[model samples]
Target: MRLLYSIVMLVLTFSASADISGRVVRVLDGDTVEILQASRERTRIRLAGIDAPEKNQPFGQRSRQFLTRLVAQRHVRISGDERDRYGRILGTVWLDGEDINAVMVRNGLAWAYRYRGKATEPQYAEPEAGARAVKSGLWADPAPVEPGLWRKMQKTPE
Candidate 1:
């Protein structure tokens, strides 16, 4: 049993380290997408270091649309070192040399999600600050509800 556990752990480690490249097959939302590899396998990826609004939240549709317009059907490169609890690869996405994760934040389509005591890179931070300053997209609301808070509120009894 111990040997089996060790082997599983080793495989998981190696899998996480593998770099990924594929064409985007679907845009599930502003921060998630399905990529289809040349081998016909599909991998779900969650855009790292950012959180866009929930589908029902304000600016949600626009966020999805923005992402779809940017990368749907395009080949992308993913350099991720981790996966989220949901088994989605957590990574930075690049399309035509553009950082799609940062682009979403810069356009005010998403928020830089600071996790584990580390804030996102300046690639995400500077644009977010600029977007907030300009009142772009969701920031245009007098008070926009954060995606995290919005998710919690959705589960509470009204």
Candidate 2:
């Protein structure tokens, strides 16, 4: 059993390290999106720059819908960065010359995520501030929970 577990761990570790790309076919929410890459391969990408409230939260759907409006199933360019503990790609998605990550923060859909990675570019910081100032997304709440955390909470058994 232990040997089988080791093999599974190795496979999962290698799988997580493999880099691939696909067109963002769907935006699941503020932090999760579905991609249809070459050969009909499908993947879910978490935008690296920002994090938004969970779908169950007040502005969760709004943030997700906002992302859809910004860019939905667009032909995008994806590259891997440092993987978070969740093994989600910390990649920058681009549609034309615009950075989708930056756009999310600017439009009040997400908050700049600077925890796992280093501080983002100053220009990147601008959008988050603007969005927060306008009370967009969770910024409007007196105390809003992050979408990732909300997901964890929902899964916990009473």
Candidate 3:
């Protein structure tokens, strides 16, 4: 089961890379964000390092609110590792030279996903470490639901 999970994760990591700079027009869930580039080029950006709760799951809206507070309708530069299954460009979002992915990790609002690739950007493992140590945001709660687990739970839809 672990091997299968790894293989599936690996497949998701191997993809194409594209560089684009644009404005963050919308925040889709937590990990996924949308950017509106010039010439009306709209690209969906998946946060490279961190994963947040799904919209319908617990803490979902809070995650979106956090993202909105951090970057709402602002200009951000996107550096891609690759596009994911949903056709969203997976990359690090930089706002004024600061990496939003790293920031999310530092805030305890996300987890450092272990997926690896060059198409994968530098999601330094330390951000999450610091966040966990300080107990920021959801981490302050006795227990916080992992985005992956939330995704799985939502799949069966009780």
Candidate 4:
């Protein structure tokens, strides 16, 4: 079992290190996008380490629009190797050499993605703090809800 785990880890590491170049074909939401790779494959990527508002949530459409303005139809480099349960590639997107994930949070369009109430990536903390301090984008809302919490509320019985 340990050997199997090690092998899986190795494979994941290798894949994560492999960079894929593609052109953004669609922006599914603030944190999700579809890209057409040079190999002619369409890949769905979930921006790593950031969470944006849902389509129905406050600032959701705005978040998507912001991302669209940044990467729509532009060629980018994707650097991530893991696959989420939804079969989407979990990775960081780079456009014009800028890290889009960090940009989203820094601009207050998204939050540093958290797992179990803890931040999964530390690099986004400072950006989030700055955005919050200035009330930028989604932060302008006095009581903006995190997308995860919003999702739960949506599923709860009223």
Judged by whole-model lDDT over C-alpha atoms, candidate 3 comes out at: 0.77
- Reference-based lDDT, each prediction: 0.91, 0.75, 0.77, 0.95
For every candidate structure, what is the RMSD over all alpha carbons to the true structure, in angstroms? 3.9, 7.2, 9.4, 3.7
Candidate 3 positional error at 156, Å:
2.8
Give me the runs in candidate 1 sitting further than 4 Å from their true place. Answer: 1-15, 116-118
Could you tell me which 10 consecutive residues in candidate 1 have the lowest summed lDDT?
A: 114-123
Per-residue C-alpha lDDT of model 3 across residues 90-128, encoded as one tens digit per residue: 888899999888887777777777654221234456777
TM-score of 4: 0.89
- C-alpha lDDT of residue 43 in model 3: 86
lDDT of 4 at 110: 99
Clashes of 4: 1
Error of 1 at 9 (Å): 12
Ranking by lDDT: 4, 1, 3, 2
Whole-model lDDT, model 2: 0.75
Candidate 1 lDDT, 5-31, residue by residue in tens: 999999999987877999999999999
Q: Looking at candidate 1, what is the lDDT of residue 148? A: 83
